[model samples]
Target: MEQIPKIIEKVSPALVSVVLIKPNKEIQEENQEKDGFVELETGSGFFISDSGLIATNRHVVFEVAGDYWVFWNNKKYFAEVLLRDPDNDVAVLKIKNQGKTPFIKLADSTKLQLGESVVAIGNVLGGLQKTVSSGIISGLSREIMAKDESYNKVFELKNMIQTDAAINPGNSGGPLLNLRGEAIGICTATISDYENIGFAIPSLFVSMAVAEIGAKTKK
Candidate 1:
């Protein structure tokens, strides 16, 4: 409705673009070509709380084994991985220097309905930090394959909310939000042959991951 723009504006501040850097490790092997130590891969993420906690895909930051970085509102800051579950492809990152930021609450994925309008926000090409796309719920209760066997569950993610929201390569790990600006899903996957075919990790999964991170942080 008329509240769409308002809701987007409100949540935009919390959405972030996560950049993974694989610092070139020095090697002793011959015929080694050395480029800059930092190589960049882009993805998106969002804030779940005001305490500098953020959620993103584990694959996005996988194998870095070095420094981690994130971008929000065009500013670059260093971050550290608080926890990661290779099985679920989710990771929790913490930024030490981040100031107070707006965050979204997780919505019940079980309640999501088809044809509901939703917005996707992410950094598409590492430069567009908060790009926005729109679509409607396309289906539910779908499954997606993880990149590797580390996620042994086959990820039969229940109550999925599908959309035609123009998600692209860099859109992974971003927010899939309802019209009310609540996060209903985590931008995760898509069909490459089709336009606007996007799938998201249901928000309930995000809630569980965040709760796990919270519990770990408290100890």
Candidate 2:
């Protein structure tokens, strides 16, 4: 409790709501010419670099056709997908900034213990923004199967960090922070039939994704 406020203050500024806007299929089919983007889904992400690089789950921004916009610090900005790792359920996005945006530091997840305290921050249910939840690391190096009925796909998420944090819908892609307010994992999924059993992509994978992005940027 003593560290919650400080963690929120230091990290909330980098957290952003990820909104996916797609063409209204129903409206288009009825009119045959109607055109407008509708809010398809909402998730959470965090800036990982001052240059506007963002870290999120690939599922958050994985629409075949849509526009991705980010709401940060009460301002909305257009974002583009920069890198994606579907197997890991990780994605990186880029936004235009004047090089003044704050970012979250990636912690060494290898140092995390099974009982270490952690916090999760994200938009919940596509409407509740900046919701925070805290818990201790419940498990590590877990293997889970995530099924997407909409896309008829099953993703085998490996080496996940399991926590008791309340990760509701729309919390995907958000950051799971250590007590120091450093991002140690990316909140990725929760079992609907279970309680306090949320999972996160360990920061080690995040570091690998970021490194891949950097390598691509250099080319």
Could you report the Cα RMSD, in angstroms, for every candidate shown?
3.9, 2.7
TM-scores of all models?
Answer: 0.82, 0.91
State the RMSD for candidate 1: 3.9
Give the winner by lDDT: 2
Candidate 2 per-residue lDDT over residues 103-203, each given as its tens digit:
99999999889999999998533457778899999999999999865588887999999999988765678999999999999998898888999999998
Put down candidate 1 lDDT per residue, 58-158, tens digits, no spaces: 76776556566777767777888887766556787888766776788889888988899998887644456567788899988876654443334444444
| Number of backbone collisions per candidate | 0, 0
User: Per-model C-alpha lDDT, please?
Assistant: 0.75, 0.85
In angstroms, give how far residue 55 of model 1 lies from its true place. Answer: 1.2
Error of 1 at 105 (Å): 2.0
Give the Å error, residue 60, model 1.
1.2
Name the lDDT value of residue 60 in candidate 2. Answer: 88
